[model samples]
Target: MWYYTLNGQQAGPVSQAELAQMLNGSLPSDTLVWKEGMADWLPAQDVDAFRNIEATPPSQTNGSNPYAAPNSIVDENIKLSGTDEIPATPIPLDIGFCISKSWKTTIACFGAIFLTWFVYILITSIVGGVLSTIGTAIDGPVAVAPITEGMTQQAPFLPSHNQSINQQTGTGAIIAGILNNIFTMFLGLGLTLIGLNLLRGKDTNLGQLFGQSGTKLFRLIGASILYGLMVGLGLVFFIVPGIYLGMRFMFYQTVIVDKDLGVIDSLKYSSSLTRDNKWRLFFLFIINCFIVLAGALALIVGLIWALPVAWLTLLVAYLYLHDGERSLAA
Candidate 1:
């Protein structure tokens, strides 16, 4: 059985002869073709089996070649914005290919990725612990008054020492939570940047965790805020819309980091990129959930491996959807 890429979607399980018949010398030689046991997709021209196939001459195809490449104009200098060449109609996602590829990458770079995650966790934990301690100290322990048989229950409208303490504690907790989230977001952006570099086979090190800065950092934060508010609002109104928007804007971070798109532009691009592929994305999410759960089951330490694999799998999906198999590392 063989499979081929047609307009950025995987198409087949067709027999070799059937694929040949379908190609009929109509598709471009650069179209990617693959079959089980092959390591990765290769241009049809590079495969031995397709060399003998000849293009159907323009004169023979009744004035129009059905397989002619789209007329979309692509900027040759831009490395990542291949969207111009992609069809606006929905594209198919290969979930199995994503997971398998992500697993292989995880194995290949386990040491660096694991160490990066460990440092992130360590910093987050220490800061969180310090914040909790400060909050506790600020909201001293509540004193309980002994109840007398005749003592009336405290009036609902009356303010008491306990209530004041509770209010102060709540305020402190909220502040702590906000600070923690911002810090984590900063670290996460850097971590994701590292993942992208790793995906491209670029060298990565610990310092990359703090690689983001200036206008790009601000844009990422702005996009994140908008994304969170929109998703939260959807979740508040109804659970379904939240899930829908969540999947729609899933690639915002990647777009911001990889393409240097502005906040609103990143959101728009993510929506465009994810259009018509939500179901497959959802399935991939579920599969990653299982992978994480399995890792959790293998002693809590398994998270060291599970978490990165899950994250890398999503990144793999992003690359696949953004540029098809071409952007993926073999």
Candidate 2:
């Protein structure tokens, strides 16, 4: 039996032949592999079973591997990535399968995910604090007049001195909140993209989270806002329409982050990709909500595990939907 590690998790117990076939020209030379005869796990290239298979070079053309055996496990629809040595073959994934994979990936990459969110919160807090302080300085102190016992200060919105100060503070807080929300939205785009990578068994670091591609950040943000507005407007008409729109446009961010597409194009692509699977996606979303709620009920500690799992599950689903759409089109 052979076992392989992906995204820092052990993923198989297949025969040597299947493992070799699955991995030959499909993974990097340095990817870890192990079997019963081995003392410990080693890189695929170092193992005798895989010595005959050469690692696919980065410069290889965007076509099927010539060296692959007749019954190689590589899928015909697999597309070559210029950045990755081995092409990633997207397979149609079921909700249950993705949920399981998402949980595993989340657990494996917990430290990185937690640190990324922590840094985001910390920076936003600092900015909000600075804004609050500046707002306070500008507003100056509020003067409170001495009142006899039982005399009620009934001026709620009459522009009293205290009311003025409170209003200014409220305005400042609102401004700071808006700024924080904007920053979080952009930061979250990058984090979401990092989570997407985790679904493919890639280990992501904090540096990558911050420096992640911003080539389509604004477009992503725009698409997100547009989707939200569409959903909101649909809800105004009725509940079912909103749910429908939500499911349909759910993958807008995924398309934007993965394809670096324009705002409108990402929305259209997401709509098309989700056309036949809206009900499945809707149920998936409901299940995930329950999963996260269950995690939150576990003294709030479970959210640390649950939230990442939910995010990764959606990414995995997006990958499948993306592949499914391509196949249908072809």
Candidate 3:
């Protein structure tokens, strides 16, 4: 089967013979075509299989081909402008395509992504452990009292050493959690940017994971707070609304990192990009959850592969919806 672009929209999964017939003296030489296993779309003339299919003469009228398959516009909302301008409307989300491409991407660049993730995990673990140790030192040790017959028979009211230890540990845990969350937000922005670069067939490295700073970082943090609050409030008020808003604004982080938009603008852009695709996004989320669960069941080692695939899948979907598949290619 094969697919081709017609009038800036994808069309057909037609047979080879049909494709040849459609191209012979009908479509232009420069029409883009793609099929499974191809890294990216290519001009009809550039693909050997279609080179034999003579293109319509330039002198002839460039009218629509009667034999051409009907346009299979992926998303009616998207209007391709044939340039680098980002689409203001949402594009189609093919769950299968996203997953397959993401898996391939993960395999292709596993070393870089895995190394980056491993470093992040190591840093967070070290920080958490240090804080916990400090808390333990501050609390000291608890002594256990031997059980006596009289003590067992009577109800004794006294402050427990366990309570004091817990209080001190809790305070340290609170501080650790705040610091961890702040670091995660910044690192997460870098990770999203890395994922985007990987999807676009660009080179990436460990340095990419720490490239975030300045106004973009601040904007991402701001957007994260607003996004969390809205979804948190919605979830608090109504379960359904919470789920809806979660899906709608899920792309805010990517928007801020990718487009450099302000906090509110990023949230609004994400909401717009997700319109008409909430159900699809929900289904994708469910699929990723299962993937992560499966990874966890595999003694947690599988997460090294599963997590990157899941994140790349999301980045692929973002690029597809934001600028069409063309943006996915270098």
Query: What TM value does model 2 have?
Result: 0.62
Q: Model 3 clash tally?
A: 0
User: How well is each residue in 87-193 modelled by candidate 2, as lDDT tens digits?
Assistant: 13223347886687777766777888788777777877787788767766656655555554664567533446666567566765667666667666677777777
Residue by residue across 83-104, what tens digits does model 3's lDDT show?
1233433467888988988998
Name the weakest run of 10 consecutive residues (lDDT summed) in model 2.
Answer: 78-87
The TM-score values for the models, in the order shown, are 0.67, 0.62, 0.67
Name the lDDT of candidate 2: 0.66
lDDT (CA) for every model shown? 0.73, 0.66, 0.73
Number of clashes recorded per candidate: 0, 0, 0
RMSD of 2: 12.5
Model 2 ranges with Cα > 4 A deviation: 1-93, 132-171, 212-215, 324-330
* Tens digit of per-residue lDDT, candidate 1, span 1-330: 456666566665444555565556667666677764567777676788876777333221123223333333422322123223223344588898888888889899999988998898999899888886666566665444544465457643244566656755675667776777777777878888999888878889989888876577778789989999989988998777888898989888888777778888788778877778887898899989998999899998888888988999889888777556666666
Ranking the candidates on lDDT from highest down gives: 3, 1, 2
